[model samples]
Target chain A: MKSFGSIRRNFAPWKDPAAKPYIEFRNVTKIFGDFTAVDNLSLNIYEREFFALLGASGCGKSTLLRMLAGFEEPTSGAILLDGQDLRGIPPYRRPVNMMFQSYALFPHMTVEANIAFGLKQDGMPKPDIEARVKEMLKLVRLEQFAKRKPHQLSGGQRQRVALARSVAKRPKVLLLDEPLGALDKKLREATQFELMDLQQDLGLTFVVVTHDQEEAMTMADRIAIMDKGQVMQVATPAEVYEAPSSRFVADFVGNVNMLEGEVASRDENRVVITGASGAQITVEHSGDVQPGTHVAFAIRPEKIKVSSKQPVGTGANAMQGEVWDLAYLGDMTVYHIKLDDGQVVKASSLNSARIHDDPLTWSDRAWISFTPDAGVVLTR
Target chain B: MQGKLSRFNIVSLVFGFAFLYLPIVLLVIYSFNASRLVTVWGGFSTRWYVSLFSNQQLIDAAWVTFRIAVISATVATVLGTMAALALTRYTRFRGRFLFSGMVFAPLVMPEVITGLSLLLLFVAIGLDRGMFTVTLAHVTFSMCFVAVVVQSRLLSFDRSLEEAAMDLGATPTRTFFHVTLPVIMPAIVSGWMLAFTLSLDDLVIASFTSGPGATTLPMRIYSQVRLGVTPEINAVCTLLIAFVTVGVLTAAIVNKRRDLQRQRDEHAALRG
Candidate 1:
């Protein structure tokens, strides 16, 4: 989260009422035979924004991206690009480009030719095409490898070529399907920043589809989490992580300990929850939830603390538990505590000191505690 | 332990190769015989080769066979590529199972049955049998082979390549020409060569489908063999073998050179 530079541009056009959407899907639904790949969905993407469609496979994220790319038409709605309807316009006529997951560089052509293909198809002048191709190669730092074929390059190099080729025409929008799904972990992390920088430099809207939550969180300004052909939630990474709207969104984005509970009492400032295991919980957020309504309390593992002795904070809610398991991860130690009510909760503490002083061990009597504002109440 | 050739393996290899090639070797040797007798070789002379040029009937049959092979192979390649595309690209079309069955039926159906059925079909349609009929028959059978070869290639083709082309502002037709076709060219080339060789060497199907004045090289050679084994026939067979060998060798050499050039380019890229 450290600032890499002082120039942080405000890319949140979604918050601006007067700002028009660069791409919009209005009540789009795509069906294949009898299966609905994308249900009735409406979404808006702003210009020059890094948007991510994040979901598991078969969750309709890829189908939504393909609809925007004009590869698949919605059986029931319209897609607009820059205020123009994108119906009956084939993919070739659409002002969008896609970098395929496989990095489908033409095997029969050299890197230069593959980058020049779209320009040649547009009947650009020969000199202009050459200049553009060279410029793209330079942008990807692959100027020396222009004459080589795709197979001759490494995986990261091939990916760069695909990026360069897809952006050579400077389309209004760029679609990337699992852009880094094929790379190794370390390389994928590095390429994520590179792709973000490239998108910024080109000032082109990028709609990336990925199943990896970390990838979406790192690269996208906003992510639309999808499930079962419908959008589950759309928000900034921090917003989704902090205030997930549903139990599904909370569990899918990160690790969470869920406690089925019923609302004991509700007020403007706080709500008391009675866990099924008889553990009383409290949340700070006030909602219209009625007393005695069934709900689930979702708390992230890192927000809870497990101590060998009873904690001394009066505002904190504490429960008696025994450590069931402990894992010492170099930077943090995770302890799985089983409460006396037969409920298990995970708590992690940062290992800031070099030496462990009176560390909690296996089967040790411990106190697990969190404040009223550390968890979210999920009604659905 | 895995790759060492045992004595038994060596013996079997030698025996298998000799069994397969001894007859062709003998034929080739006798094609250069000076004497008229087929078995008794007077000396190594080019007499049979010299007489082969003067045989007008053999020359005419050779010309007919060449024309039929060229026409049929060309037609078969086009039709087979279409069939492969249909089978691979259109996965959910109606009657897909029946279409695939029909495409593959000619491959395993007895050649005699196929030839007889085709002959009857032509007669029922009142089409005069000639070089055109022979070519039609060749096309019918060889197209299936081409389809099988090209279909396997298409099965392995990365479909995303086509999508990439379209995403880059190329229409479907242009994508096929610039991306799919060039990538599948090797398979198509081999399929066409196979069709040509099959048409060139066919005897039973051609005899059943051909009419008067459309005698192919196989038909002419069969008739002469029935009469007697002449050194002139051996000479013609030797020349046919030479032509096929040269063609196959040239193709292999060209393909190898392309591979080598690509490898060298890769090395240069890595080094620089």
Candidate 2:
């Protein structure tokens, strides 16, 4: 079996100065009445990049996608596609297609007609339209159900038909808005991998907008975490997970334990923080901050180690606490420990063995320890 | 207790149907009576039908009514569909409330008041009262009914389908014709049928609007009824009822077949 983790992924087009961006949103600002949907946002997307706009609801991620799809025009600024201005062009004239969140299949038409609709709109020859429709049906594994209406098909099948119809004309870019949102959990998981593989196979630039953080993490090569119509951070999934630039990004993407602290002192290579609990935490790296400046120390729950005994290690930061709560998940165990000063911190460990030799219960005295490099410091 | 409830339900069903259909059934049966006296029982005969065919005045009135119904229904359908689209799609336009009010007000307006107002308007305008005037009145009233029907169906329409069509490179006009029209076709057809039947059955508006040489079937039948009830009138009524029944049954069967086919296809897909 092949393991994706063992292989290094190459994402170099974004860093190459000579490569021109395929799509550019230059200072795009969209306003509906008095509400600012997308604030002066500028972004660059390269060709064949699977980019995801990740945000909570009403965070303007979908507004950005709609602007690209030409359903909406920015109140100010311009969008450029292949170095040409995309202003004043309607959605039908654009070289991009979108799969709607509702699937939006024509209830009156059969699947074959729905997929062929775009090709017919393009004034393609009849023979070519037929062949292309057949090919799209095969691509989505829906060849046997071409005569069925959208209502007759299952949700997953209808989703595939929407996908095929959106891609029937082989658009330069495919924009998906909450693509698997209507499917069951098991089907959604399967479709996520299938979508990733499809994007890779077609080498098409895909811009997906989703509120699901895990879906964005699983499928996108690069993700832009958005909040209040602004990009907080844009990086690879691993970078966003390991080195989030802000406390919001850290908290949005996954679970994290935040320790409020003030910088006690700064050395040439390391900074010592005095937590609100009065525990001294020494970090290996120092930020450009003055001494006594307030900051937040964040660490993932998986990175913290919990032991019943006073742990002996390579000078790791340790906190004394009692187990306040414990949840025994089938694959992992989460322990919430409360310090003497009444601060709760969470730590999780994988259940590698079928049976544990020892288990920590509620009210058990424990020590939570982590290395200096396991946590990140955020000023915002 | 269940048996008693079921018996009560059966009784009510029978009573309801009898109350509704008994008069029409009697009228149809009496149309075929051989005797001239309506109250007398007579053997079944086709003499009334033959007399109806030979009655040139009644036939002329029927012909005029048919023409008005056909012309008015077509024009009403077009105008009503446009009104429905405007009201639903242009949500933020000025005077929308007034427009919707006018569209719906005629549905509940007293027919005598509507007829009197229309008659006064025609006289004020100095337009000749004839078939043209009757058709205009019919169109005016029937258009409202068609608009109400189409509007109800349009309210439940999925607007995203039109967006999808446009997203798939179809122009707005093409999207309406190819997607919107086909999906809402059932409502439009039923609306047209309603307008047609309403026009055919109208008496007061036609009477208020008609001039010489434009007497409709109902006007002629009313004059004859004022004098005396005739078997010929019954025969004509039976014919009209037959036409309406055929139209309604065809529509119902077509809708049923479509629904059944959809259900079957869904079942097959589930099994697969």
Candidate 3:
């Protein structure tokens, strides 16, 4: 498995002050009748960046993508593409293309004709259109099925034709709505990488909307987690996963054990928190915090260590508990340990060995421990 | 078990088909009778068919009916398809409910009332009634049936296909011509065929709207039948039945072939 971080190393244009945003949404809000689908939200996407809008259904991600595609207009704000206002421009006039979730290929046309449709719309020469169509067919690896109609092809083939047709015109931006959502698991996983590679090869700014977090994490350079038509946090996959900004983000992205507590003591580099269950958790932190402030310490299951015996050095970060449940997932085992104070803490350990020498079973007394930097202290 | 039908099912199927086709079979078999009377068959002969061809008045009426059916069906198909598109696409326009209700009103309205109202309107407008008036009346009533057929198709139409066309830089007009029209063509064709058949067989509306020298086949046959029952009438009826049966069978075959092609394509897609 190829790591996503290594594919686009040192690509942080958002952090650079001089790098002007290629696409800017300035306080865009869209309301349909009595329902507000997209609230007043602003976001900036750089050129050639694979940006993803990640959320559950009806979180305004699709609305934002539609606004960019010119299928919809923002009610009260402006959308700028390459320093030009996109307001009042019809979808046909805009230099943006979208691949619909339904893979809306013209059913009457062959694959070649479907790909040639946009090029012909621009009144490109007939020869040029044919050449472009041929190139797109080759690009998406559908050259052999160029003459087949959409109904004659498989689902994945139809998806590729839709992609080819949308990108054949070389639009300034390509918007994809739930691009890989219809494929089965193995195909979806394979297509995610293909889409990323295609985006990089074309160097077109790609903004994808998907509710699948794994898809967003695998293909997007940056993801914006949205809830109730508002963005909760915007960061890379690692940042959003490792250091979520809120309780919702931590819980929404993946499974996490949230320990509700209040700050017990604070220092320059670390803070100790006393949980509601009377368990103390010490975490590494640098932000200024006052004592007795309420907070939640969020930790992923894989970060904590579970064993039958107590560890030697850990004091405040360790707690004695009984093994409540365990699930063996082939690659790792998750242990749910119930503390004496009636709080269940989940811990997962990698199955690196073929045979376990001493595995903690159900109802066994155990101790769960974590390092100071393993968990994030969320104040909200 | 799967291939064999039960005795009760076989009996029901036989009774259903016999109930529908027995009268038509009797009419068809008697068309070849040599006797002048339609009910009594003296012997087999082609005399009635030969005389039927020489009947100039009947020939002229048939020609007039054919012309009216062709012209009215074509015009109604165009106007009705446009109406269906407007109703289905622009769902929230002003007076939408009223417009849709009016479009569908003719489907359930009494044919006599429609003919009477159209006759009154033509008379009030001081327009002479003839083949022109009959064609106009046919277009008015038959367009609603076309609209109904096309509307149901438009209802199930995937709107994203149009959006995809627009997204690909085609104008709305171009999208309709290139995508929407081609996709709904089957429905439009069936609607036109329906309108043509309805106009060809109409007698009451034609009677109310037509003037002298504009007699249709049904009116001619009705007048001839009132004078006497002739074997010639049975021949003409059989010919009409054969024409309509050929048309309906051709349409069914075309639809069945398209469906089979699509199923084969899907099977190939799955295998590939």
The DockQ figures for the candidates are 0.63, 0.72, 0.86
TM-score of each: 0.95, 0.95, 0.97
lDDT of 2 at A374: 86
TM-score of chain A of each: 0.96, 0.96, 0.97
lDDT of 2 by residue, B149-250 (tens): 999999999887888888889999999999999998889988999999999999999999999999999999999999988988999999999999998899
Per-residue C-alpha lDDT of model 2 across residues A33-76, encoded as one tens digit per residue: 89998999999888999899999998899999999988899999
Tell me the tens digit of each residue's lDDT in model 1 across B83-165: 99999999999999999999999999998998999999999999999999999999999999999999999999999899999
Worst 10 residues of 1 chain A by lDDT: A1-10
List, in the given order, the native-contact fraction of each candidate. 0.66, 0.72, 0.85
Error of 1 at A83 (Å): 2.3
- Per-residue lDDT tens digits for candidate 3, residues B193-264, read 999999999999999999999999998999998998788888899999999999989989988999999999
The most accurate candidate by DockQ is 3
Q: State the displacement of the C-alpha of residue A247, model 1, in Å, after optimal TM-score superposition.
A: 1.3
| lDDT score at residue B210, model 1, on the 0-100 scale | 95
| Full candidate order by DockQ, most accurate first | 3, 2, 1
